[model samples]
Target: MKWEHALKDYKLYLKIERGLSNNSITSYGLDVEKLIGYLEDKHISVSPLNISKETIQQYIYELAKTVNVRTQSRMISGLRSFFNYLIFEDYRVDNPLELIESPKIGRKLPDTLSLDDINRLIAAIDLSKAEGERNRAMLETLYSCGLRVSELTNLKISDLFFDEGFIKVTGKGDKQRFVPIVQSTQKYITCYKNEVRNHLSIQKGHEDTLFLNRRGKQLTRAMIFTIIKQLAVKINLDKTISPHTFRHSFATHLLENGADLRTIQLMLGHESITTTEIYVHVDKSHLKSVLQTFHPRK
Candidate 1:
């Protein structure tokens, strides 16, 4: 089949079978598109099923030069999954990227804000403006709930179960989980909803969406990043921070303060304990304490 037709079917498989998010599907599609572009540039006429491992290796070699080690690794993984899907569907007897290996890169720990730094950033918000309250609420929810920006943006009013102290978050692959919400966060969100959001002539489809742009629609992920970046700039913070930074900080802070990795994993909605183990590196002292407290030798 032509590359385009194969990619379209692959995206459908990702959405319907694998249940990947739109953003994830787009990223995976781009990896395949990059391979197609490389083939076109070289005037190589090869069908998806007929593409050779040698050609894929050459494409990867060219790709490595243009991207950082981590990005290259991710793209390689995406391509590998695509070929594996083709193999599963019986469209190909062999996978072109089966033997390809991702580069061995050091694990990059996430950046985090100190508690004092978080306070300073939040304090810098201009409370005089109407959006100030909204921004404050947004940032508070971000840090307090340890939510991804998408989860925060798509959060619906019905998801807030303040009486029970939890908010339902729809995470990657459209999986949903209930994460506990602190009263302080509940207070801020309630203030924003009752004070600011209720006043907007909210667009039809966005009535249940918790955070609305001034245009009375759901907040975009970029807008959330812009808010955090601008706040960082206003405070002259040296670190490059994003909504995910707050998430990292939340997990790190919890671990540093004696919260277990398993609990953090549950709160972060991680599908694997391995994903949560990254926090173990963030606090070596906490690791030492765990050894002292739990080891039979101790």
Candidate 2:
């Protein structure tokens, strides 16, 4: 089968069978695309099934010269998954990546903002501008809901069950979950909706999207990252903060204050409890206290 045809099938499998989101599917596709690009550059036209282990190893070695260890690991993992899918589909009798080794890299925890730092960052926003109210509301929603940047950007006005204290979040792979929205977040969102977003000339197709640009278009992921960067600079915060940083901070603060891991996992829209366990590193003392207090034998 042609590589393009195989790629299309793999993407469909990831979406329908694995239930992955567009961004994730694109990421996996890009990983394979990287290998394709390398093959083309080297004048090697091997099909996916024809690729050898030596070729994979050489590509990884070349990748290590230009990419970070974490990215190298991710790329290797993505290729391995694609090959595994080929085996499952019976396109290949053996996987070339079955013996490929990923680079050893330690897990780096995400940066967390303390409550005071968060307040300071919010306080630094110049609320006199037209987008000020909207910015404030966005930041509040980020921390309060512990939303992934994509989740916040795609959030819908219809999803806000404010009267019932929850907002529906469509997370990775379009999985839906209801996260409790505190009164503080609700109040800011309401303020933006009534005062700012209501007055904008919303573009077509983004009417229900809760956050919009001045032109009424849904805010792009890059725009969100830029907003956080500007705020971090204004506040003179030492850490390099992004939209995701707020999410990490949200989970970290919650864990520090005694929120359960399972609850945080649900709020963060993590597929597994282990994914949520990273926040546990923020407070060793708190985890110990919870263990000592809740254990029946303790």
Question: What does candidate 1's lDDT look like per residue over 1-298, in tens digits?
Answer: 9899999999999999999999899999999999999999999999999999999999989988899999999999999999999999999989888888899999998898999999999999998887888999988988888999889999999999999999999999999999998999899889988888889999999999999999999999999999999999999999999999999999999999988889899989899999999989988899899889999999
Give the best candidate by lDDT: 1
- How do the predictions measure up, each by TM-score? 0.97, 0.95
Instruction: Count clashing residue pairs in model 2.
Output: 0
| Candidate 2 positional error at 257, Å | 1.3
lDDT of 2 by residue, 227-288 (tens): 88998898889998898989998888888888889999988988799989887876788879
Worst 10 residues of 1 by lDDT: 93-102
Predicted structure 2, TM vs. truth: 0.95
Candidate 2 residue pairs that clash: none
Q: What is the lDDT of residue 249 in candidate 1?
A: 92
Predictions in order: lDDT:
0.92, 0.91
Q: Give per-residue lDDT, candidate 1, residue 240.
A: 93
